[model samples]
Each structure stands twice: as structure tokens, then as C-alpha cells.
Target chain A: MSEIACVECGAEIRLDEDVIQNEILPCPDCGVELEVMSLDPVQLALAPEVEEDWGE
Target chain B: MTRVAMVITRVRAEEKMLLEVFRQRGTDPELIRDEELVINPSVIDPRWDEFDIVLQRSLSTSRGLYLLELFDAWGVPTVNSLRTASICSDKFKTSLALAKAGVPQPEVRIAFTPQSALEAVTELGYPAVLKPMIGSWGRLLAKVSDADAAEAVLEHRQTLGNYPYHVHFVQSYVEKPRGRDIRAFVVAGETICAIYRSSSHWVTNTARGASVEQCPVTAELQDLCRRASEAVGGGVLAMDVFETEGGFVLNEINHTMEFRNSIEPTGVDIAGRIVDYALALAAQLERGEGE
Candidate 1:
């Protein structure tokens, strides 16, 4: 496991060992949804907003 | 070895669960990002042939439909075939299929212009719903309680919305007891499990912040789901049903369903079931039985 700063709250957030690319997780501090953009460097970005045509 | 392709836009919780289930089953399906894909219709790409079957899981309905159609044209089998996705992606098309199949659904009317749509909504009476021809997650749904509200919504659609939004699909609003509706997950023509999404808001989609609870799959629900699935050309589907004074009526049929919030409440491994269905389909196609 590794810790990353929450982009929204500037608080440290823990990530699981098995987190995969594009996986979505909520920041424990601010609760903003973040997406795992990459794994090698452990990049996190805010999840994309839902589009008009997005659904299932 | 059965090769499967799980197509997706972004790896949401549902996709993550599906990947985990596939790994647990010793079958590591290839993850195909829809955005990175480039298909040359003039030339056949051998990369696509590597997978026996493609699982259409893109969150974008248009992307999913286009991908499914392309895969079908290439003679590649896909879960929820192109025909199913085509119908499910459009609300009007879904209503027609359900009506033809004798499946119970809410009364709906299609209109081309905003004026006609307002008239249609008026005919359906107050508390009617105006939905986009193609959309999901209960987005852009207007519950018109009066003529003023209907007119306002129609004007907004005509002025600001896109081409699809102008083509109004109006339906009679069915009152749900306690603002709750049922979502039944159907896999391979079988109703595997169901959940009740309750919300104080009129739109009860889980994505809209609704709470979920397990809903028992009764014989009535099972039969309804079976007929609905068959109506849409059969595959993995999610049926939204509303309980009314008359009985249960299907609200919509979803082609690429999300089941992350359903596993715990329903006690069903929805992702596992989906993976199993896809793998079975891949094996069958590989054996030439699907042809």
C-alpha cells in the first residue's frame, strides 16, 4: 500500500496494493472521486463527469 | 483457450469486479479500451480475431452500440448482440419491441417537434415524464406536473438540447410505492437477482444517489424478465420495473448493465455471472456451435 495526497483536500489517502489503472476511488478526506490514471508513478485525477450519453 | 475481450471506457467498480472475477476463474480476459480502438472498415484487423467474443461494457451507449455493430459486421460474437444494443439504447425502440412482444410497459408517445410533444404530454395527463430518446442513469427526465411545466420543458429541449432531445419520448408517470422501483438483473435469458432502489427524489437510479436493498425474485418477476429479455434479442440485460396499481410495468431495458451496488444486497455475484456467460458464449463460438 502507498499513500497519496488527496487532490481535493490535500490530505494523505491510502491506496490498496492491487489498485489497477482507471480504477475509481473516493478520497477519504474530501470524498471526491479520483481515478487511477497510471500505476507506475501512481497518478490520481478527478474522475470524469458523467456525460449525457453515458449510462448502462 | 477461450479468448474474451472486455470492452470499456473507464474501469468503474463494475468493471473492476468483473476483472477480479475473471481472474479468479483463471481466465484473464483482455481489456479493450474503446477510446484507444481504431477500426479500418476496409481492412480486417487480425487483432480483433484474437478474441472469440467481445463483451460490450462501454459506459457510453453510442460507443457501445457502434462497437457492437462493428464487431457483428466482422463476424465476431458479442454479449448483448448489436440488435439488442440498438433497441436498448433508444427508449422508443425498446418500447416498440416490448409492445410487440406483449410485455407490459408504461404508455409512451413519440413526437418529433416540441409542440407535438407538449400535446402528447398533455394527453398523458399531469405528472407525465419527458425523456430523451437515447439516455440512461435517469438523466434529463422531467416530471411535468402541469401544462406550464410541460411547455417549459419542451421549450428548453427545443432551444438548448441536441437533436435527439428534440425528438421527445413522453410516458405516463407510474407512481412507485415509497418512491422505490425494482431493477432485475437478467443474464443469458435468466433473472439472476434484483434490487429495489429507493429515493426521495423522483428519479431512483442508483447513480442518482438512491439506496438499494435486495428484492426477492418472484415467479411473476422471473417470467416478465424472461419475456423482456427474449423481446430484446436475448443477452445480459437489466430490466427496470415499476409497481403500479394494475401490476408491474417495465420502465426501461439496459444493454450494458452496472451491478456493483447490487452484489451485497442481492447476495449474488453479478460480475461472476456475467463473466461466466461471456466465457460460455466464447467457448460456444469457438466450437462453431454459435454459427
Candidate 2:
């Protein structure tokens, strides 16, 4: 997972295993919208760092 | 020659206006009921080449997600897309997104259980408003002005049983203009039009017997609305904002909203404007695809 393009804006975005698993990135060029996983584990790496802040 | 399929409930005033716009543009459009969709990722068949864009209409958050996933799998472009829509559809998620984006939204809590709701009420204090997470038309809206009332509402919810859809959205009910709320229609980066919605009841939704009033779009309100839309990943959005003593607090951000009634007074062809902006986004996607 080196670089991926945004589905909406098509800006080249570099991805890390960490960020990819975490499902987060910013279009360094377009500065609009994000490409998040509709479902996960597409490439099947170790799961992204999970955020643990769930409550009402 | 792009066909645009609108995922809507039923063809109503706003939907009719959008269809007219599609016809005016010489674009083929189809109206599909949201409930008809069955979500599956393997069968990604949308006749993608035939349709250039999908416009999501006013649908519940749950059904809206199903349609979003359906389109996503088929690789069709969508207005308000699915990611933003999914976030905005849930009141809790919407507030969290706004707060994360540094946009001003009222504090909110999600109560999955009745006992949790009681505890949340105790902590958040009274005069809080309780609503379902995925709700439209302001249905099941209750303002618990006191502890006893809050307990009663909680008990009622308890009696309703373990309904998964029984998720509650508890918000600090700002003493907004007695049954009045401001709705700002945003297209792209601009606030296309703004209106004031009022009702005799506490919940001021047009669907809840609220009347549309002309709210002067002051620069302050305009800026707030614009910022709110931008914060939530811009496209076409109808932001429901409330005026509070401190300033303005965002009530809700609806990606696929209805505004036919309010737009005429503002002299903006909201339906046309939204279509135009969506076309621009589709064009953007195409250009991106080509690159």
C-alpha cells in the first residue's frame, strides 16, 4: 500500500498500513472529501489502530 | 447524456422539481423507492455507463446507508455521497463530526438503553430534548422539562421492548425561537437560500405541520450555515440551525433534504441549483477519473 487515488477527487494520496487499517487519509491536493471504507479489510493487513471512545 | 436516478420516498413537490430539472437538462432520470433496495456488495450492477450520477433524496438514515452501499459497490457517483450522508444521518455521528471539524453543534448524547437514558438525563440535566437517532418529521420528539417527565419518557421507551431502532438522541434543548428553526440550503460552497420554519408545536419541522417563514439571511447566519456545510464535507446540504443566547447552535445537518416550499420565496431555484452543483461534482469525478 504505497499510494492510492481518491475516488471522488482522484488526488494521489500516499497510504501507510497504519492509516489504511485505521481507514483515514486526506487528499493532499483536492483538500475536499475523504475515501473511507464502505467495508473493511480490503487488502487484509493487521487491523487499523482503533479509537476507543464510545459512550453516550 | 447521463441518467440520474433519484432515491426518494415518493414523488412529491421537491422530487417533481428535480425531475423537471433533469428533463430540462436533457438527462434521463429515474425515481426509485428506497425501500426496494437490498444491500449486497457482490452484485455491483447499476448500468453505471447509462447513469452518470445518483441523487439521494430525503430518506431515513438506515435506508440511506443501504442505498449508499449499493451505489458504492456499483461504482456510481452520488450526490451528498454515502460517507457524508451516513455521518450526517445519525444525530450523534453528525454532532461528533461537526465537533471534530471545529464546527459549533449543540452537545448530544446517545442512549441505547432506558436505564442509560435515565442516567444520561441525570448527568445532562433537565429541559433536554429526546428524539430517535434516525428520525424524520420530528416524530417521537419530547422535551423533558423535568426529572419526572424524563423518567416517564424513559419508562415508555422501556415498555417499547428491545427495539434496535429505539436508539435515543438526547440533546440540550436550546430555548430556540418558540417552535422556530432556521434552515439554510447550501450548494457547493455557497449558501443558496435560507428560511425560518415555525410550528405551533415544539418540534418545528415542515412535515410536522410547521409553516415556512422568510428568515433574512444575515451575513452572520450565512457564514454559520456555510461553515457548517463545509465542515460536514460539502455538497448540497440543508442545515437546521438554532439561535441560542450564546449565539447559534447547529440542530441538524441534512444531506438529502426537502426545500421546495422555502426556496420559491428566496427566489432561488433550489432544485435546479442542487442539480447543477451535483452535475459539477459528477464532472469533477469524471475529470478525476480521466486523470
RMSD of each: 1.2, 16.9
- Please write out the lDDT profile of model 2 over residues B139-162, one tens digit for every residue: 567899888998788778667735
Index of the highest-DockQ prediction: 1
Worst 10 residues of 2 chain B by lDDT: B40-49
Candidate 1, clashing residue pairs? Answer: none
* Tens-digit lDDT string for candidate 1 (B133-233): 99888889999999999999999999999898889999999989999999999998799999999999999999889999999999999999999999988
Q: How far is candidate 2 from the true structure (C-alpha RMSD, Å)?
A: 16.9
- Count of clashing pairs, candidate 2: 1
lDDT of 2 at B52: 75
- Give residue B22's lDDT in candidate 2 (0 to 100): 80
Q: What's the TM-score, to 2 decimals, of chain B in model 2?
A: 0.90
List of chain B TM-scores, one per candidate: 0.98, 0.90
TM-score of chain A of each: 0.92, 0.47
